[model samples]
Target: MKLFFSYLKSHCKTLFFAGTSVVIFCGIFALDNLPLSAVGYAALLSVCVGLVLIAADFLHFRKTHFQLLRLAKKVRYGLDGLPPAQNRIEADYQTVLQELYRGMTELVTDCDCSQRETEDYYTLWAHQIKTPISAMHILLQSDENENRSDLQDCLFQIEEYVEMVLSYVRLNSDNTDLVVKQYPLDSIIRQAIHKYAPLFIRRKIALHYQPVSFTVLTDEKWLLFVIEQILSNALKYTRSGGSVEIRLESGNTLIIADTGIGIAPEDLPRIGQKGFTGYNGRQDKKSTGLGLYLCRRILSKLSHTLRIESEVGKGTTVKIGLESTRLRVE
Candidate 1:
């Protein structure tokens, strides 16, 4: 009804002109002394013709409206679903749309190709560098000299950087090699602790770790990486004779607390962000700022949560919440 009214409004002037023309013709017939009944019949016939023309126009307009609506729906779903245009205007619009889609697709393809190439190059470079790093570690281990400890430390740092590069690459890969399974939480903790045992000895930092009786379903490799990162950070900032404690609290929260130069309050919020080196990192130029970022990301992927509490001149406590019930056992 609304559409009909709108159509009538648009054709009102044309209708008025047609009616006036009919009235003028009747007046001419009347001036020529035509019969009144004949003139009235002629006027009615003219009005009937005009009504038929208007109805035909309305039908055409209604059909076009519905067709355009359907086309809009198809375009909304997908560009490829756009139907063939019936008019020159729609054809021009479709041409522009197709060109835009093609250009966007090409841009995306180029980006993907470039990203794959970069990942491949770095992955290869990281592997190639590891050969020498391994050789150095082996050579340093054979040496019984007092400086061997320093050499080993340097080798460890190199290994850490290499691993960081590999991890960074893998994190952005299309296919993740994540193998999730049930593993003893204590075993994972011990592995991380053992990796840094030499560091603890060298720094004379006291380690206080107790075995937890719970098992967690997670990707052991990724979880170990997270644990190692947390442990490394704790050990890096702690002073000699200071202690690092590892404990499992209720609700499956694993706490790693260290008597280290703690994170500043303002800097704490941004520590998990990539490339965010806070006060301690600025003070210690060797800090890469990727450790916490990687840890947070990996933990999140494993459906775990990482929370940090710290105060300057006091200590830092890192809590990792592990909920085995959240896991899909299969």
Candidate 2:
């Protein structure tokens, strides 16, 4: 109804002119003492015809309006839904839309190609760089050099960063490697602990681990990466003589709590965000602000949740919630 009124308003000038002409014709007939009944019939007929025409035009307008709405919904998929042009103006608008659609399609294709090329380059670089790192590890360990332990630790950190580069690349790629199944929970946690044994010893941080004998449905490799990242942070912020403990709570929540330089209360909210490093990161120049971010992302992909609670001077507790994850019983 509102649209019909607006449409009538648009042709108000024409309607006014026609009404004025009818009034003038009637006045002239009256002044000449001519019959007014015929003039009244003709004016009534014209009004009825005008009403019918306006109703038909309103129906067409409504149909086109609905068509444009549906077209807007499908615009993301394609631009083939332009309604049949009803006038020269509508036809010109459709032509402009087609041109815009063509340019947008081309732009999307180019961006996809460029993104693939960049990912490929980085993947290649990560693989090629691993070879030299391995060689360096071999050289540093051979014959038991005086600084072998320290050198190996540094090399290990370098390897970790390179692995992070690969992980970051994989996260953004279309193809990701994840094989989910029942994995011994203890074994996965132990593996992560073992990998950082040297770091633990070097930092002189005590590890208190309680084995929770069970199986969790998850991707072992990805879960291990998440655990390792947590362990790395736990060890990084903990000072000598401090302790880190891994235990199970509430049957399905795995907790890694560290007696380290805990996170500030204000920084806890944004701690896991990508490229976000709070106070500790600023103090530790080597922090890349990606470990927790990667851990969060990987755990989420495994249908698990990551939660952290920390106090500035006390400690931080990292929890992996596995109760709600998708797992089928054997």
Candidate 3:
């Protein structure tokens, strides 16, 4: 009924013109002294014709209206499901849709190409740089008489930066090599500590680690990277003779507390953000600002949480909430 009324409203001007013409014709007939019954019959016949024409137009309009509604729904939900156009106006709309789809497809293709190129370049560059790094490692190892501890440290830093590059590239890749399984939490912690043991010895920082028997479901390689990054940061800021403690608390939380210069309060919140270096980093001038950011991201991927508490001039405590029961295979 609403559609019928709308159709009538749209054709009101034409209806008015038709009615006026019929009245004029009847007036002419009346002026010629036509019989009243004859004139009335002609007027009724004209109105009947007009009504039939209006009904036909309403039916056609209703069909078009329903088609438009269906087309709109298909365009919004599934463009591929849109039916073929049956009218000129619908054909024009379909042409515009095709153009838009083509443009979008081209844009997506270009973006994918650009991303692949970038990944290839970085991957190749990382591999090329490793050759010299490996050669330098061998040389540093062979030259024991030269007291090459500083060279060894620099080499380690270089390797870390290279690994960071590879990790950053892979982090955005479509296919990530993640192997998740149940592993001994203590074993992972030990591996991380062993990797940084040389740094601890060189800096004379005391280590306090307590073994905890717990199994956690995670990608061990990724978790080790996170732990190493955290440990590296703790060691970097900590003074010589200071201590770093690793212990497991209730609720399966792993706490790594360091007797280092704590982070500033205002900078604490933004530390996890990529490329964010606060007061401590600015003072040290050696921070890459990616360590904690990477740690946070990796732990989040492993369904764990990292919470930090710090006070300037005191120390920093990093809490890793490992809710093993909530783990899932991804």
What is the C-alpha lDDT profile of model 3 across 27-106, one tens digit per residue? 89989998999989988988798788878878888887887687777564436755567689988998898889788878
1 versus 3: better TM-score goes to: 1
Q: What TM-score would candidate 1 get against the native?
A: 0.78
Off by over 4 Å in 1: 1-78, 324-330
lDDT of 2: 0.87
lDDT of 1 by residue, 1-330 (tens): 998998888788987888788878978998999899998887788778877988898997777677667767765344755555769998999899888878887888899999899999999999999898888888877889889888888889788888888888888888657888889999999999889999999989999997889889899989999999899889889999999999998859999999998999999899899999998989998887998999888888889999999999889999999975565664
Candidate 3 minimal-lDDT segment of 10 residues: 74-83
Q: Write the residue-wise lDDT of candidate 2 on 126-218 in tens digits.
A: 999999998998788674778888888889988889888888888878776778788889999999999999899988999999888888888
Stretches of candidate 2 off by over 4 Å are 1-36, 323-330
Candidate whose TM-score is highest: 2
My TM-score estimates for the predictions, one after another, are 0.78, 0.87, 0.76
TM-score of 3: 0.76
Clash number for every model? 0, 0, 0
